[model samples]
Target: MSSSDIFIGEIIGTAVLILLGGGVVAAVVLKRSKAQNAGWLAITFGWGFAVLTAVYMTGSLSGAHLNPAVTLGIAIKDGEWGNVPVYFAGQLLGAMIGAALVWVAYYGQFHAHLTDREIVGDPADKAIEGPHDTKNTAGPVLGVFSTGPEIRNVWQNLATEILGTLVLVLAVLTQGLNDSGKGLGVVGGLMVAFVVVSVGLSLGGPTGYAINPARDLGPRIVHALLPLPNKGGSDWGYAWIPVVGPLIGGALAAGIYNIAFA
Candidate 1:
């Protein structure tokens, strides 16, 4: 595909991916929403469907490699680095756009959730911090925009993220073999979507399975930048784990694919 096509396709595809993926989290987490507390099953299925929709919509244009790890894995597999930057740019920008849209869509819900003294806790108990306070850990609404560890061990969190992303990129790389090497076509999208849901269900407990760098970083940045009251810290201290771990996982998946599957 041409650079322009790849860029535009990735932008639109990743935007839609994050819109639905992040939207699901907002629906479950935000107060006053009908889907509030719909639980993890809803989140897993919602993300799977998001992947299915985005892939089918943009597969023709850019193969819909909406995740940076997926793009890196494909680049390594195919030895095509020319378009990697374009894909990364588009995915990050698209992710931010989609996250912003989520806030827009859930404007009232966000206001209600954040302003709730019960949810944010008593202001008298703790001083109110800015939306992007770096010292504090994740805020109540941060989970909607990004992933965080339930238990914060550096090695454990890194390993979990790497493992989750390895499964994802490895599955993506080997998908062509299942369909006679045509890339992720119609059936492949559905298959990959299930893989995502499976990853979330099985391996997501530790660090929320941030298998995609752009998926985490882009929205975290948005969470920091957006004007949400009582929106607590962006948890910048743990930010690098999601980004670095996924890239390492993608590269590792490529190496394994080269050795075993190639």
Candidate 2:
């Protein structure tokens, strides 16, 4: 495929990824919304569908590495070292743009559903309510790109994200190796869906399994820009966990695959 073709595919694929992945979070977490508190099932299915759409759209050209972590992992495994930076930049840029679009699409809801006071919150209460209550609205408003533990400490939260991403990437590699040329046309999609479902069902409650960096950072920039009620966008203390966790997990998965199959 031409470079331009791959670039366009990456853009479109990443946009779809953010839309569906972030969109689901908005549906489930937004106030007085239809899907609020719809639980892990909805999130998992939403993400699974997002992956399916992205892969179908860009897999032929760009391999649909919507997640930078995934791109990095693939480069490590296949020695596509020169293309790593280009892919990473494309993924990040696409992610940010996609996240901005999500904020725009949900603009009306954000204003109508929440008040400015809620976004900023009271300084005194910030310490207490910031982490807990923030999850309810912050994730949907900013971007569904990161993960954090509901009540656990930072270490546990980070661990949860890492482990979740590990499972996700491992599943992807396993399916790619075992199902290739076996008529598993859509099995990759199904595998992704099942892996996400497993994580959400079992491990989501702790950290909202943000196994992807672009998913979080891109939307976060949007959240900071978009005007919404009571939006604090405090960067959630240490925002790096989502990015680092996923990378760690992706690399670990690649290494494990190499050891086992190579």
Candidate 3:
């Protein structure tokens, strides 16, 4: 694909990816939404379908590598670096746009959720000022945009993210295999969607399975920037884990694929 096609395709594909994926979380978590309290199963399946839709929509234009981790893995596997920056830029921009769209779509729900005293506590009571309290760690609705761990253990969180992303990128790397060990198709996009759902169900407990750097970071940045009352910190301390771990996982998956599958 040409550079313009790749850039435009990634922007559109990733925008759709985050819009649906983050929109589901908002639907389940935000007040006044009919799907509120729909639970984790709903979230996992929503994300899977989000991936399916985005990939199918843009696969022809740019191969639909919507996630930066997937882009990194593919680049490493193919030894191509020239377009990596374009992919990264498009994904991040698209993610931010998607997140903003989610906020717009759920504007009333966000206001209701954040301002509800029962949900976010008294606005006048002041935020908890502790070294490791939940209030200071993350905003009330940050999960709609990014991932966070139930238990804050750095090593465990990092390892979980790395492992989840390793499985994801590795599966993506090998999904094109045919019966004759040659180039062919095997419902690759649908299989990748299943892999995402599998990763979310199996490994999401530890760190919410932020296997895609762009998916997490771009929206997290938006969360920080948006003007929402009582929206707490963006959890900058934990931010690097999602970004770094996925990149490391992508690189490691490339290495493993080169050794075992390539």
Q: Candidate 3 on 1-262: residue-level lDDT in tens?
A: 7889989988998999999999999999888899999998999999999988998888877778888888888878878889999999999999999999999999999998888767775442232222444454223388899888877788998999999999988988888423332111237778889999999999997788889999999999999899988788787888999999999998999899999988
TM-score, candidate 1, is 0.92
Give candidate 3 regions above 4 Å deviation. Answer: 122-140, 176-186
Candidate 1 lDDT, tens digit per residue, 56-169? 998888888899998888888879788899999999999999889999999999999888767665433222133334343224488888888877788998999999999988
lDDT (tens digit, per residue) of candidate 2 on 184-214: 1355766766676787777777767778887
What is the Cα-based lDDT of residue 32 in candidate 3?
88
Q: State every prediction's TM-score relative to the real structure.
A: 0.92, 0.83, 0.91
Higher-TM-score candidate among 1 and 2? 1
> How many clashes show up per model?
0, 8, 0
- Give the worst 10-residue stretch by lDDT in candidate 2: 176-185
- Which RMSD does model 2 reach against the true structure? 3.9
RMSD each, Å: 3.3, 3.9, 3.4
Clashing pairs in 1: none
The pairs that clash in candidate 3 are none
